[model samples]
Target: MALRPLHPSTTPLFVAIFFLSFGALLFQFVQTRMFSAMLDYHLTFLVVSGALLGVAGGGTAAAVMDVRARRPSSAQLSIAGAVATIVALAIETRIDPVSSGMFVAAGVAYVLGVIPVLCVSWVIVRALREAPEKSGLLYASDLAGAATGGVLGYLSIGTLGGQGLYGVVAGTALLGAAALLVPRPSRVPLRVGLLVVAIATTAVLSIWGETLAPPRPGPFKSDTMGVPHEFARWDPLARIDVARIGDLGDPGHYAFLIGQGYAGPRPPALMMTLDMGAFTPIVMHATDADLAVFDASVLAAPYAVAPRDSVLIVGPGGGIDVLNALRQGVKSVTAVEVNRTEVALMRGPYSEYSGGLYLDPRVHIFEDEARSFVRRSPELYDVLAITVVDSFAALTAGAYALTENYLYTEEAMLDYLGHLTPDGVIAITRWYRDPPAEIARTVGIADGALRRLGNDHPERSIAVLKHGLLGLVLTRNGPFTSLDMQRLRTFADQRGFSIALDPLAPGGQLVDLASAEAPPTDDKPFFFDSVAVSDILAGRAQLPYGYAVLLTTLVLSLTMATVFVLIPVYRGARRAAGNALPPGTVVALALGIGFIAAELVLLQRLTLYLGQPALALSIGLAALLGGAAAGSAVSPRVPLGLRSSAVASAVVLLLVLGGVPLVTSATLAAPLEARVVIAALAALIVGIPLGTIFPRLVAIVGQPALVSWVWAVNGTASVVGATVGTIIALVGGFTLLGLVAVVCYAVAAMFAPQPRT
Candidate 1:
């Protein structure tokens, strides 16, 4: 008997799939933000891992259901989406930030968060298997929706807020459910009523859900100290809080103001906390009248000699630096800040107290990451000041040892030097740490940059001051002038500030990276990323705080991926008719691991260029998926041999390796528009060949029953790759990971098996 196609109408299924893909990506974006707030930013890797695991589970579920006597309906998948939306909403509203019991919360999030992703994955896998010939087009549609979802996610942050965004996610899922249901001509009345209710419910929630949602906790709020903050705001980037203190207990403790997380030495006039323990003041500045107090002025020392024709302050939290520049009679100031919410707070509630410093005519503010802003700016500055902008939580987060810090690298220092005038000064301040490894790191990085600029004697061009916090000043052309020396001596004498290093002074070199005490570098970059290697060696009962927790998370994620992959494969092997372990399956697993590892490195590198994680993730994901779609769509038309595809992929890998430096340089030199163009083009170029292989493998497999199994294999392998890649990076940076990816692709290509025709 002649029957309709397995997936039914192309148009309706495509539309439903578009909605499914859109909703899934949107949910992922929201979840990432929410979870990062609850945990920390490093949870991003785990979030991706959880979502991938969901995809694998969905594929497995689809395979199991399809093999049954009665095939599961699309309506069931749609209903799952609806339920998932509700569960997500509940999770968002009910859960509080778990500072202590984080693992428990992470587990809960992982289990619940995977559901909706599983629903969409099941639907997508089923759709692909049903119409294998149209796999490329369907894949393209899925990716296109995902790409658009990234833009939507970025917009939702400001437009909807957190609660409102969840409502949007729920509404999007509901729309997908309706799309899936609408095509069922047999159930018009039920579908109509259901669709109407979903739409109405979504609208009500989207418009007013935030009002009903519970208030989120401020990250910096002290549990012991019941003092209410003057102002506070939370965003994806960070939780910022501002408070005023009036504990005039001692006259020596008379600082103008105190900020949480400020990391610097207490100025002479400012009787602030000198301990470099955990809590550091993020911002503190003297009043305009007290600007002349040298010992109390850490940042202001740079402008003592250099003419402040134009001043550029990176990481201007609370606009204190801008205020200092204005007070010092600087002609112009440009402040670059990364966090949007922080900038808004500084311009809003925090502005009034600072005398509207951010709104001042001479002050030009740009909400951009520090390195990115520095790279794109055309103007040269007499003084460049980098105040404390360290993420303490991230520093303490053990697993993020491999996490990229472009701002502290040798290349980054060179870029900063390139933007400075001939006699310009670069001032950097950090909380003093014992063993003084950070000092060594800074000096080494600056010296390297100077050496690149043809400066033979880098030490003579550097000066340092250590009172409570550490301060280092790097000069562009030569040693500090006579005026600079006089100003520094008077400043030190006025406030009990000891000069750590000066070419004219006693101390030879402030810090020596060549002295075996250097912390970490761009190549060996593990500033705050040391795992408890010695403890693991000594057989300690529990791992240290950060390493133990992160290692456990990694082990758990990898184990889960292994279990998810093996169970379905084992089941499928028992039931699968011809050659249970097919050549295509091997190809899928290998390609899956290789592609994701390569892609992860690409995304991290792009972050350095883009200067923000959100932007990097959005652009990198879009370009990668979009390119894959293009390759997949074209693969069927131009069928290449498996060996040829592998070779092409290797060639692309080589291209990526060769092109990274070019992209890095271009990003710094190019204008904003050009930088985006450069990044997008690079991502797309690398994605095409790798994308072509999987679709070809799928086509060659020739068995519909095994499609979902292959997908599960691919997805699970990807999870393993992503998880293991982090550890590898922790050991050997992103370069080694990229090399691993390249090798995986090459080996997979060599191991390519002939499909059973």
Candidate 2:
């Protein structure tokens, strides 16, 4: 049947594959680290372009082997693979910006794309020569190693980190070469001395690599990032990657039942992200509340008990809603929380630390998002107090935020309105900085829209909208007293703030736009309505890219795929029976990589627009994983005749999956932490199916021993596609990445054999 792998003499061929794989991978790790050392995470990608060039060179070598068919001996092929890998790395050193100067960065990346292809080609050639009868054995061996590399890297990198990762890469390669000399009955001993020298060289270089620096705490500081985070000055553009507790209050001491999520330290004031602004009389008299607590700090609440009734406070901190309600005299209070960070601090490390009022036994705390508890709980509040930042638009964008949708939407309004005692009123307060008449008009529209829910105003509710760009509205569906207004005015005056009813023209707020089923989608998304804001706050949205690079890439790709591949195929450069992928395939792969590079360039634009680099990274990582998973799974089952077709399907799927997220504002606004987790889980679910595809395909082509070889080729292709995908996202942007995936699949499809027996 098949015996190439069992022949034992091919051990050298396996060793060569090991050497090349490890060597090239080591080189890449070093390249990456050096860039980081330069304080540049972005530049290494261009260097990766150089790495891919090495891979591309391997592809060229593969074609050369196909032409030389059966002409090279196993030893000859092994020697060639090793020499080629060395040559590729040496060449990379000259062009890689990490080692070379920065002037040729982009050009170097473009040129480097040719190297890895070449190295991969040489390894493939060696495997083929060693086991011509066992078609895919090289692939299995390589992938098995890949699995090992992944696990070891994961476990070790945490300890070793960036520079350490390079050390591992270098060590693995050097050790691999040493392992080759252990086998007997061949010239293994002759190479032992040389292998020792290589190991020594790697060691010496590791010491002088300059990429490595002395260990220090806050490890990212050691990298070449020119400026250590400790030394780095704060800029709004420089987002806070590391989370730290800004303030901690003990809940037992200062109990707060704010609708906003609970966040405070144990035994202190119980509160969340909202630290009280000067919204309360007690807080105004107190010192800490007046200072900007946590950038738009809303309030810190203290819990207390009243004699008879059970009380539910939404936002306990702002102006002491619970304390006032207690004075208004409530028996007990229940609070809801969403942002766990807020609740944990209040309930966790620093409870009772914030203030004196948190010790009340009448207060019951719930650390969950508001709507969720409300949806499940049968208990209704006698008075639901909603304390939020002002100016619906600005509020929606920042921490102290809420929207008109909650009050205006049919479902939301009904939910709160239904639960309200004929006298139970939900209170809301919004904030602003430099508000204008038009801004007031929008607020007026928001308030007017709420009247649809049977909201009644003692003072024609719109009366709360006032000057100073900051206003507070106290709207209710029930009759209330001037005494209540006096208490609110008293609280406001104590906090250096004043409020009066909003002045309206003709019919107040002057508008007809709020009646639509959903928020208006004009130049800017009009989604700050309470209901919509609630949906957003609760984490529901599509999470697609916006200002997508997709549109331009799509058009350019049509022109590109035509020019890069079609031209070659039309010239008969890709006859399946011939060697080297008809030259057109090679050109297409390179061009596809180029297009991907372009898309990566476009992603920067998105980052610039949204001012969120994390979003860009999320998009890039998702596409990378998705594409690798797809190719790995489908490559095996792909019929020789339908290869191109399957790849085409994959291309379209990636495009839809990755690029579509940019189009929907709802999706764009969704938290990436949740979205990315979901996508990664999806990719993981399909991993096994994809992983098994190659084994099955290799089995179809050759005996079990040969399957390993095929797996290697597949892994190599996947690595190529993944690296290229990231580049497209980084350089060309994600749109180009999708296009490249499409192109790769189409290339595979075009190579699909016409049906024949």
Candidate 3:
């Protein structure tokens, strides 16, 4: 039998489906941003995993439930989901994760977070089941809404904050509910009431939500716990909080130490923190004497070697490094910072309080990622300084162990070196750990950069200095002179600091890269990850915090899938005798695993190229889903079988893997606008083929019962595939992850059912 055309009566249903998907995705993005600020950064991944698991649970329930029987309308479910979303946000936002214990708090968040997603999934599934003939239309509506949601989600974070976004999501859901009742004249009054309430609630939340439920820092965060913050701002990159150290009413009580153990004068300053941990100070009422305090700190070791005419300060938070350069008598200084919210705060709100540091005539500021700015810079500098730039919360929790840090990659070092004068030095400071993995990685990166520059002896171009938990690595384009080494040793000795590496001195270079540790490349930029699987298995190193969380998620996902999806579907299929396993089940499962794994790889790869994680995620997801929607719309005309779709997908994945290095090298210095276009095009190319697979498989398994079972299988596989993709990237990088996706598609091709003529 031929499928029926989309009827005019179903227009309202499709529109409601669109809003449902839009609200669901917006809710997910808001949850990710909120939890990222409230808990350890790695927990953000859990948000994604939890949402997918909820999708699986809801999908399974829909498969088992009788949709033909009278049940609650889609409009009723949408409204319930809206209310549940608000309640979940309210509860999760107020709880102190540290006091409640990390696991307990996370468990609470995970359990409550699933309710809204499950509700959304239930509505979508029922819509699909009711209109199997219009499956393509419904799926297209779903993707289009999700694509729009992703782009708007990124844009709204800067304007709405997390709490405000929650309100927007609720309003969107209510609007969807109203749309569902558009065909019923008798429900006109209810529709009008819902619209009015949604608009009013959204308006109130957008105006005052931040004030009512302000984001609180975790106890482990470095910001002051009990005191009220002077200023706070939120954006996609991070949350910036400013706190007055002492009595705000009395200027006499305001004092700042250059660093711990420093005997210099305590200047008046205000504390500025990023993500509640990476702290810097804004100097208030400072004089020449106050500016000179930086000269006494270990961070000034690079400037001590020789007089610098010009300086480049990367991650110059609170303008501390810029002030240090000025105190060293540099003629010009360029400060590049990634977070625009922090820059706005310093330039607009705290200008007078900081003595107009950013307004200085000799100082120039650029709001850009460190590596991207350096790669496109037109001038060379006498010194490049990066001082304790990354967030301490992320570092200590090992949250970034699986994430990319282009700033610490060998390619980034090469970019820095390329933008430095012959005598200029690159200075990087990090918290020193007992095992010194960070220090070793820093040295290895510098060494790799120097070797790539054709240096015969890279060691002569690098030096390391340590003072209390702070370690600084200095490297230059050219070798450090004997006189320069002598000056560094003299400075370290007088300050009671230790020289971990000095080319001219004997027994130098105490920090060596372990044989298993490799210098990070842009392809495998995991600078914080030093523990290998062998080490973990041999009892040489314990599992990192981030990995442990990932394992727990995987276990939970498996358990949920087995209980709610697999067992119920198995029993139902067994009752049907010969139809125990659906013909397209394997293909659906493989598509889910392959599609998500590929998406993750694209997201990670494009983040550095686009210069911001949020931008990359928004553009990548939108382009991919949009392309998939287009593919689904045109699937009927394509003269291809399921086997052809899988083969084509595998070929595209291979092309993408091979093209990554080339694309990155060519676009490393391109304008952001141009890079964004290229990245979108790349993702769209991959999504077109992937989108064709599922709709074609649905046509083969025409029975509603089997179709729902296959949907559950696909959803379950997605829940597990997310964790599996992360592990693959953790072990063998994105290249291996992409290859695994290709293998999955190939396996799907082997199991694909024959097309009906």
Model 1: per-residue Cα lDDT over 88-110, one tens digit each: 66775466544535566667777
> Across residues 507-539, which tens digit of lDDT does each residue of candidate 3 receive?
333445522377898878888887788988899
Arranged by TM-score, best first: 3, 1, 2
Candidate 1: 10-residue stretch with minimal lDDT? 269-278
Q: Pick the candidate with the highest lDDT.
A: 3
lDDT of each: 0.65, 0.38, 0.78
C-alpha TM-scores of all predictions: 0.85, 0.42, 0.95
Which ten contiguous residues of candidate 2 have the minimum total lDDT?
231-240
Predicted structure 2, TM vs. truth: 0.42
Which portions of model 3 miss their true places by more than 4 Å? 1-8, 67-70, 248-262, 391-394, 506-510, 514-516, 574-577
Candidate 1 off by > 4 Å: 1-5, 69-72, 97-100, 182-287, 290-295, 304-307, 339-353, 376-378, 391-402, 467-477, 480-490, 500-527, 530-549, 574-580
Residue pairs with clashing backbones, model 1: 261-282, 262-280, 262-281, 262-282, 265-469
- Per-residue CA lDDT of candidate 2, range 1-757, in tens? 1223334665554555555454454445444434333323333444444454344334334433434436443334434434443443344344434344443443443344334434444555445434544433454444334434433433333244434444444444444444444366675665665466456544543454223342211111212222222111111112111112224322322222221223432222322211111112122222333322221111211111112255555535322454444344467767653333333444433344433333456666665434334544676555555554222332432311111122222333334544555445554444433323333433344354455555554234332523244444443444444554555445444444445442222133222322323322221122232223234447673211211112222333234324432332232232332433332233234333433432343333233222233333334323432344344445445453244334444544464435434442233333445444443443333232223333233334332222222332333343345354542443333455555644554554454333322
Model 1 residue 592 CA deviation in Å:
1.7
